[model samples]
Target: MKVYLRQAAMAAGLLATAGLAGCVSAGSVQDPMSQPATLVPETKTGVVLDQLPPPARKLDVAVYSFPDLTGQNKPGENFAEFSRAVTQGGSAILIDVLTKAGGGRWFDVVERNELQALLQERQIIQNTRTAALGDQAPGLPPLRFAGISLQGGIVGYDSNETTGGLGARYLGIGGGTQYRHDIVTVALRAVSIQTGRVIASVTTTKTLYSVAVSGGAFHFVAVDKLLEIESGFTRNHPPTLAVREAIQLAVHALILEGVQNGSWSFADKKAGDAFIRSLETEGRAVIPVDALEPIAAAKPVNPPS
Candidate 1:
């Protein structure tokens, strides 16, 4: 027993020492938020939007606001924290996603969230020209107007809607994995500015998954000596990402809905038909994980002249 005890202690000591090296090592990439950052969507809906073809003509769309309607806090071990369940800058995220859709081929979004600021800036520009060069100053371009208006906000945020774990133990040494699910819902609608009619509406939801893994060991090396060690890692999916995904899904739905009803069209007729056919097939709704070879094969190679 004493001999086995010494071995366990030595092994555990080695593992603990090795783990510490990660703390001081200079990694190839910096961890998230080590500096200023941007929101990136990584969901199936986002993937679909990226794969979809761009519209033949852009639509003028205005988003006045998309604030977080849910006032929930982050769940704590014993109590909730003050941190919000979703990002407060959801409007900005939505705009970014809209512009990025179809490789920046979706909508021409107007600036309406900060109307007063925009108006003030415009007034300053006009005043500056008049003050500097009298009446000969060049006139500023007119502000663009939206044909359709978008409305709604992040309607809901639910945390720990699902939670589970799996583990095993042998001779006081054990390992385990746990997972949790959170969801966010967003609602959006498009209304005609000229007729004041609601053209389309969509409600979409996204689920955030979190996973944690851990390993631990414990044993009695001697009658009076004992040893224990634990190591764990957790990866959390942000709720904001989920929100972005829901919005992307909604936009894709809107595009399909419009095209099907003749509300819009693609510049090329065959491109439109191919896109519609792809939408019908689930396989084409997203770009394949290894699509380079498949895409190359689909396109005929030109013979050398």
Candidate 2:
């Protein structure tokens, strides 16, 4: 009996050490609170947006608002919560995408989201100039007008669209992993400022994944003595980043749709046609992974005699 307990204690210690090593190697043990501020990491969709062909001429565009229409509350396992599931700064994300599209050669975005504040500031400048210089006061140049208005919003936030897990245990030592999937959708449209017409529109969707990994052991270290140890980590993909990717993809689609419908043109006809074909092929490859089916539980392992 003493020999059996000694062996079990050694096994538990080895299992615990291995779990700690795995977590550290995976780089999931660091505390993010200690990190310095950094620019948002670029996503796959953002990369494609940057690689798009230059437009024939930069279009003046305005994004007045991009509200969250879904009204989804953050999902919780135990209780209700008032916090929203998605970011409220959808307009800011859209504006940033427009400004960065095609390496800043696609669109000139105007400040329409805060038009009132801008106008007030301009008025203050004009009044000061008039008071100081009389009729010789130089006037502020006219505010640039937008030729096209971009309108859109985060339209959907579906939680727990897919969930699954797999686990195994042996000799009172084991590990398990679980994952959950969510989807976010965005829509964008370009409207002609003068014609009151929707020139182009596109909708895009992106998936968010949350995963957890855990390992633990329970063993008798000595007579009437027990040892228990657990190690694990959970990773949740930011919903805001998911929303940003969706918006970026929506912008990319809108640009392509515009080119196809003659609402816009590219700088080089041959290069543009080739680019369009390549992106269409890439678009079809963004299918979501299958994670809906629950994994079968692992059967217990018979202890060594």
Candidate 3:
């Protein structure tokens, strides 16, 4: 009987060891590449606009293309969805400001249908011209555009924490606290279409916050229950309000830069600057002369008339 008992204990120990080994092996079999890698932090670099040459002449500008302004969400398992969202949000705000300030002079701001037709024609003409040039035809004129500028690009939403709480009674030891934080980042750029140069670029970050209970007992609760509590709390605090404000602030910065230079008018600049300052006490943006230099440099040494 003693021998039989010993044999049984040995078998149990062996089985336990095998089980642990199997688990480790399984974990090791997982592809490391399958997991998302940590992203590196972005370094802020000053734009060297001063290197550009002086503007030959401000051409009668038109909105050649506007960023995606519909705020339409892309549907798919691709980064394009996120990209579209940012692009649309930033574009909408930028266009509104530009239209109001443009005094109808800065850009043509063509309608969607008209813009599409023009683009199609431009493409066809470009193709024909290319072919003609390739064949050494006599009458092919080079394509000419007065100016081009990036109105805006991807401006992401901001995040913040709205509420937090602690519940010691839930756990046997110290109370647990719950916390929530919201985060968002937005990107925007202004470009000179004629020179194909980016005149201004801005990125903004916003943070919001909320806190709740934290404890080991909280983890033991049903997932659905925890989620329900979180949802109810979040319902009290929507995230977009702070984000919208942040976006407006960023837009204001870009407009201020445009106004400082002759690209945008002073009246619009004053109104925008005031609007931004009203939001925050110290809302100010200064564009160095150096920044504009690059735009000048990008122009052809002797552009065609």
Predicted structure 2: lDDT: 0.83
Best prediction by TM-score: 2
Per-prediction count of colliding residue pairs?
A: 1, 0, 56
Instruction: Write down the lDDT of every candidate, Cα atoms only.
Output: 0.76, 0.83, 0.45
How many Å off is the CA of 29 in candidate 3?
A: 58
Model 1 RMSD to the real structure? 10.2
**lDDT by residue for model 3 over 1-305, one digit each (tens)?**
99999999999999999887666653254534344556322111111111111223332333434343335453333445553323334344444444433233333333332467866777787678778686564443543444444444434433332445656453333445666555556566666655666766777665655555433433435756542122222322333444444455555455545544445443233343344344344323345434444433332322211
Give the residue spans of candidate 1 off by over 4 A.
Answer: 1-44, 283-305
Predicted structure 2, TM vs. truth: 0.81
Q: Compute each candidate's TM-score over C-alphas.
A: 0.77, 0.81, 0.39
Q: Any residue pairs clashing in model 1, and if so which?
A: 5-221
- Reference-based lDDT, residue 252, model 3: 48
